[model samples]
Target: MIKLANYTQGQWQEGTGPGTTLYDPVLGTALASVDAGGLDMAACYDWARTQGGTALRALSYAERAALLKQIGQVLQDNRDKYYDISLQNSGTVQNDTAVDVDGAIYTLSYYAKLGGKLPAHVHLEGESQGLARDNAFASQHIEVPARGVALLINAFNFPSWGLWEKAAPALLSGVPIVVKPASATAWLTHEMVKDVIEANILPAGALSIVCGRPEGLLDALNALDMVSFTGSADTAASLRGHRRIQHDGVRFNAETDSVNSALLGPDDSDAAADLLVREVVRELTIKSGQKCTAIRRIFVPESRYEAIAGAIAAKLKTITVGDPRKPEVRMGSLVSRQQHEAILAGIAQLSHHCEILFNGSTEITIQAEAGSACVAPMLFGAKDPDTNPLVHQVEVFGPVATLMPYRDTEHAFELVRRGMGSLVASVYSEDPQFMAQAAIRLAESHGRVHLVNTEVAKVQTGHGNAMPQSNHGGPGRAGGGEELGGLRALKFYHRTAAIQASPDILNRLIQNAE
Candidate 1:
């Protein structure tokens, strides 16, 4: 079997130790060994900052954007190979794989095009503010590249999209990146990076990857470095409190696990009911509910609880689970056997507070081998969500959700807030007045709220889709970081400085001063 290697210092190096074997999620067979032993983390950072950072910083925004566009085009041409790898490792169907592979290319291309419209150098903040009574002195803010490297620690669910999304913004800001993908699904990420490097898509040190254990990497970082992580809450908390982040002042941003909720308004119209049911089902089954933004707590009007729950359960039954290579399988396996077991454990904990509305069996009839990592979709109904703390606290990061009934619109809002904070939420209502009222309350807790109605329902991007142009992070338990809101993401890699001086001096300092 092939061994996954690390790309650093302008060369690919194999791990020194005997690494752990990676398994094909669908077939339960060993695919490759992953290791990052004996690699010099300090040298990797030095190379990226000197070689990669120098090359990227020397170019104008427009020129850098052109490079991104070229990379996107190359990846698009070779998408089929990525799809096959995604299937074998991630166990995702073609549609699911497209979300990762195609999404990555689109994000890069979008950023490339956006960069072309921007100025060549430091992004000026608002108009200069007059400081003196005579208006002779003024101050202005300008953002410049941080002159450091970005270390990206990604989750297992989205090996492609996760890397490219962060990379696009960092590169645009003239910062290089070093990615450490989750060990479980590093194969797909490794292959993608390998292709990009071979094609000369990026500068020699602009991008690098280290698979297997992330030992010595964190200690190698200094205050000048920035880290963006997406994973579990515990891991995010630990990383946040790391000595380097706490004392060294390294920038750290996290997108952690959240119990995102979806609320159905008190309106009993058939149109609203249909939209709610469809969205709930889609959020549950998409990528087998491995999404951080997937709906976990579902709130409905007390009178319409049975109708909504029954509709969702009936729709979920029609989904087929098996190997992603098969045409009939609508839902595929989890990322690996370890993830399967974790989901089962989460479901067991959730079952303590909520009754199983629809329990998919572990004994599944699948097209793949008998030991494939496949789990059935599970739905739990909490009779009193307010009383059942576990239903609100525990998150089963799979095709599982908890349904709860609310007494009124106010009660629905309260129940949704029980999740503390979330990445996204959806409010289904035909009445514009009710939606407007409920949305105001829901906005306090959710980063993004989907207002679903008959008119926009046809074109709506559903609940779990985090678009490139919008912000993707949330506050409180959701990690309290902002990402990908147009040019906002670029600010993460840049530092803002205020310049105060006389008009002529200010004019000389601020390029393109109005």
Candidate 2:
């Protein structure tokens, strides 16, 4: 098996000893292994800050954007080669792998184009303020790169998109990056980084990846560095409590899993129901519902819960689950045996409070020889959502979702808010007033409120897709972080400072920024 190596100090480096084996969820074959035993974390961080960070900081935002474009092109050229690696390491079908691979290239390209609109390094926040009585003295707020490394600890799902989405803005903001991908599916991430490195598009230390155990990963970072994590809430809490995060002033951003919801409007039309059902099944099957924004708790009006549930079930039954290499298999296995076990345990936990609306567990028929990780889609129903806290509290990260009933508008909002916070909450309705009110109510806790009707049913990107134009994080249990809304994503990697001087001097500073 190929041993995954960490890229640091301007070269590919491997661990000192044997490490964890990465397996194909289907067929249970060992694809690769990773270990970080011998690598020097502090040295890697220092190399990035001094080499990559310095090289990047010397260039203008536009130049950095050009670098991003080059990197994207390289990935696009090698795109076909990544599919087999993804199938082996991630257990995802071609389409799902495209969601991760193609999506990353798209985001990088988007940022490359978006950076053309920005100034060299100084972005004036607003108009200058007259600090003194006379107009001669003025102060202006400007945003600049933070002069640090963007360290990312990503989850198993979307290894490609997760890294690029965070890296695009960070690199555009003139911050170098050190990525620590989850070991279970680091092959695709590793291969992508390797391709970019081999193409020699980035400056030395501009991008780095450390696979296997993150033993001294956080410890290597200091006050100048920032971290963006995507994983569970418990893991976010642990990272937040780290000394570097709490005491040394290391900036941190998190996109943790949450019990996300989808609410149906009180006066739902047939068109609205049809859209909701399709989106629901798509969320469940795509990437096997391992998405951070996947709909976990679905809330429907009590009057139409039965009808909607049946429709969703019938649609889900059509999904083909098996090996991703086959053309007919739409849904694939979980990433690992550990993930499969966790998914089962999560299903068992949710089953206590919900009745099975449709159980596809027994219907999963693999087209190839596979292991026990293959699981079919399963749907559950909650008769009363307000009382059952577990349904809102637990997030079963798999191709599983629960349908719940809410009495009315107020009850629906209450049920959704019970989730505390979510990345996205989709509302299917055509009523202008109800849609408006739903947006207002749901936005209180959700990062994005997807309002759907027949008008844009065909055009609206599915609820789980985190488009580059919008924010992709939420408050409370969702980690209270924001990412990927056009240029706003650069904010996390930038530092703002107010410069006080004469108006003419400030104008010259802006003019001479490059």
Q: Which candidate is the best by lDDT?
A: 2
Candidate 1 C-alpha RMSD relative to the actual structure? 1.4
The worst-scoring run of ten residues by lDDT in candidate 2 lies at 363-372
List ranges where model 2 is wrong by over 4 Å: 363-370
User: Candidate 1 residues 182-256, lDDT tens each?
Assistant: 988888899988888999978889999999885678899878999999999899999988888988999999888
Q: Can you give the lDDT of residue 424 in candidate 1? A: 88
- Model 2 TM-score is 0.98
List pairs with backbone clashes in candidate 2: none
Off by over 4 Å in 1: 362-367, 512-514
